[model samples]
Target: MRETVYIFLKAPVAGRVKTRLGAVVGMGRAAALFRIMTDWTIAEAQKGSWETVLAVDPPAAAHKRARFWPPRFRRVAQGPGDLGARMARIFRTAPPGPVVIIGADAPGLRARHLREAFKRLRGADAVFGPAADGGFWLIGLARRRAAPDLFDSVRWSSEHTLADTLKTLPESFDVRMLETLRDVDEAADLETAMFRGRR
Candidate 1:
């Protein structure tokens, strides 16, 4: 079965995006950095066997397309409130198949990573690509679970994010683990990403 992959993206607005890295790299450079990474993510996910959707926020669809997205892919806004709320909103909208939600900042995320997630979802109820920082860069779900509790009562963006999410998953659900990857959240992480790429 074909899986629906949601690519959650923030508009590469200078000050609004990558603010944690902003102090070290400056917002101008932070946005530039995010732009490069987001493009890499989109291309990687587009490589094989899945349907792609770009879910963004501050909601003008066409404007998002013109700025960072390709003309062919569909787009949706993240919608009001926090990160969890926005992500839950889209999970509800995805069709009954495997639905994989991924963040925009993982420099190592690639087409094969996504393909493996979908493939693993065949036997698992959920699959997570745990980030070193304790959040997940990628999460995929099979149709049997209702994700309401999946995003609830947790810290968003903190080291506890993944731990909190694990608390909400149903024991009846099967989960698979994927290769861990790093998400670029600061200048140091950016340095690591560049260094790894050069290797």
Candidate 2:
């Protein structure tokens, strides 16, 4: 089956990206870190077999002329809506096939993780790579069936995010869970990532 991976990203502008981390590390440094992480994520995710698309926020036109992104990959504006709404749109509009979406802040994301998510989708209706902080780092839909209202009532950015999203799915939905990964959100998360790297 054709597979597509969407990497959700915000333009690396000071005071806008990684604001939580920015509060602690200064906006300039935070934006810088976000840029590095986003670059790393795209590079690693591109290693997988699926087509990689950058689902950029602030709209495509804003960054269309920007030279930051690699030309080989496709770019699309995330358009207006909440996170769930935007994600649902992608699942609904993307070419017929499995679709996986991930945030760019997770430095631990690797090609193997994405490859495994696609493999799981072969049989499961959905797959989630749970995050250590109770949210999920990755979400994928097989698209064999109509996309379900899986993101409704989700308390985004809360510890209940993943659980709330799971609760929204139909009882009959076959869901698969992947290994938990860490996503940098605050100073503590950044520290954890740095420590892990030294190991």
RMSD value for candidate 1 = 1.5
Q: Per-prediction TM-score, please?
A: 0.94, 0.95
Q: Distance from true position, residue 64, model 2, in Å?
A: 1.4
- Per-residue lDDT tens digits for candidate 1, residues 1-199, read 5689999988888998999999888999999888888888899889987899888867885355477678788888878878878777877877767889997899888789888998898888899999988899998888766755877888988899888888888868788889888899978897665447735
Q: What are the runs in model 2 whose C-alpha is more than 4 Å off?
A: 61-63
Instruction: Name the top TM-score candidate.
Output: 2
lDDT over C-alpha atoms for residue 47 of model 2: 91
Write the residue-wise lDDT of candidate 2 on 111-174 in tens digits: 9999999999999999999999899999999988864776898899989999999988788889
Candidate number with greatest lDDT: 2
User: Which residue pairs collide, candidate 1?
Assistant: 125-174
